[model samples]
Target: MTTVGFLYPGHFAEDEFPRMEVILDTTIRLVVNRTEPGEDDRRPDTLRTLGEPERLAAGVEELRRAGVESVVWASTGGSFVYGWEGAHGQTTALARAAGLPASSASLGFVQAVRALGAARVAVAATYPEEIARLFSEFLAAAGIDVVATHSGGVTTAAEAAAWGPDRLKELAVAADRPEADAVLLPDTALHTTAHICDLEELLAKPVLTANQVTVFEALRLARRRTWAPQLGTLFAAREAPPAPVGWRPAGE
Candidate 1:
């Protein structure tokens, strides 16, 4: 049986994992870590705490013992807020620690968009304008052109996770632009797997969300071909997966 290991924050919406496993038809083994919301731990910079060497290695070791085929650093903000190069370093550290292939939800959005053969994209984030811009910058560094964006100004990861279809649909529509081949909602805290297909229909464009792409990116790193027509085009196509993020010791 193929299995994917995920390292997530204690505050992420846990209910979605079981459903994502059911929808994607893969086993998801998770290692939940504490996200210390400093005086304002809920803020984006706090995400950097999760990538600290010792903390991340511990989670990766747990998945190694369980024998997950791949590891995914499943926090979008945690890595993206670190910038593109920083996100790469985090996933690389995870792969080396797990001694297997690896990826992250933040980087997963980049892979998912390209795998669908899309170069132009739109972003609908639950963050404030500044935080949302960070996600946009992360994507741009990957050579993806962001045609439009919508920020919900939702302050904390917990609040972002609780949003329902009404908010998600509104964001998707607002972010959709004529030039975009796809729309991306870039917050891992949001529960998005179940609603991906419906939103794609509503926007008339491929919709890739934090949770959906995270799973697929791990599967791709495992070199697994998965086609969840319900989840959107990212799953069904057999395109070349992104190069697995390689391990680099800090300051190397």
Candidate 2:
């Protein structure tokens, strides 16, 4: 079995990892270690602390004991708020601290978008407009264009975690534009694994959710491939061989 570790921030939506493991039913093992909760706001400063190398490093021993082959910092806002270069450095630092391959949700989205051969996408974010815009900027740096964006104005992970299927579908439908290649939901706090296929079907396009790509990235780092149609188009598509050990997606 390929064991991947997830260093998740706070308590919200980490359950999605185990839920995914159950759905995937593959040799891939998802082991999550929760980092201490920080201020719930999405401000740049707050997010910087949330994704701090020290905070991520503090959780390394738990994952190491779990025998994880790779580690992922599974918080989209925390990572993207750092900007592209900083986010790359964040993963590098985490990998060094964990003594294992490391990636984060923001980077995962970029790789997932490229893997789907999509250049343009629509963002459906639960963060406020400003924070959501940062994600758009981050994607642009990676050569992905944001055709449209819809922000939910949710201020905290607690609020986002409370969002149910109806709200998620509404946000995705509102965010999608005909010109976009796929719709992205970039909040790890949002519960989405059980609804990925439904969201894609509803939009008639690929729906790349934060937790989904996070897991996909962890698997990529572990040099493992899986076929899980239930997880939506990213997982259903035949993936190429895992990139080399130190591979960073194009703009890193």
Candidate 3:
């Protein structure tokens, strides 16, 4: 079985980790954020963002000790605000620390979009308009166009975590753009996987989310990239072969 390590906050969705099990039959080890004494809640208070270089480094060490074959940061806000270079640096650093392949939710979304041959994507987010614009720029760098964006101003990670699958489905319906080829629900904090099949049925197109695509890429790195019909349409792809086994980044 493949070992996929997740670095994320202590709070998570019930549907998030189980989707990986259904798709890959993989074991997930989570290295969660350790909060200070005053901060009991694992949720963010505001749009307030902070750098976590040291925490990520520690999480990498924890995953290495666990002997994980692949590691991924399950938080999108942590990686995305730093822009492309920040995300790239964090993934490279984690790969070196664990002596395994590493990626983040944002990068996984990019790779998934590219693999699906999608030129235009509709965005569904729980963030504000400014944060959505940041994600749009990141996707544009990878040659994917953001045809349309939708945000309901749902701030704080905890608020997103509390939103149920039915709400996520409704959001997808409202966010879908007729001109776009596919819809990307890019939030690891938000629960979207359980509604994947339902959303695809409603839209008659592909529906991808942060956690599902992150696991998909981790499976690819582990050389266990088999399609799972339950995960969504992206898994139905059959063209590309899995990467070489025991693949580590250069100079690691």
> Considering every candidate listed, which one attains the maximal lDDT?
2
Runs of candidate 1 exceeding 4 Å displacement: 26-44, 238-252
Cα lDDT listed for each candidate: 0.75, 0.89, 0.68
Q: Which stretches of candidate 2 lie over 4 Å from their true place?
A: 240-252
Off by over 4 Å in 3: 26-51, 240-252
Worst 10 residues of 1 by lDDT: 243-252
Q: Model 2 over residues 37-81: C-alpha lDDT tens digits?
A: 788887878988898888899999999999999999999988998
**Which tens-of-lDDT digit does each residue in 1-252 have in candidate 1?**
677777777656756666766666554443333433333244665767755655667776667776678888777878888889888888888788778888889889988887866778999998888888988999999999999878988888778877899888988998899788788998888888778777877876678888788778777787777655666656644554342233111112
lDDT at residue 36 of model 2 (Cα atoms): 90
How well is each residue in 1-252 modelled by candidate 3, as lDDT tens digits? 456676765565535776557555434333333221123222333221332555666667766776677877766666777678877887887677667888877888888877777778899887777777777788888788898888857756667888887888877878888777778888777877667777777777778887788777776666666656567777764554242233222112
* lDDT of model 1 at position 251: 18
Please list all clashing residue pairs in model 2, or write none if there are none.
none
Clashes of each: 2, 0, 0
TM-score for predicted model 2 compared with the true structure: 0.94
lDDT of 2 at 89: 98
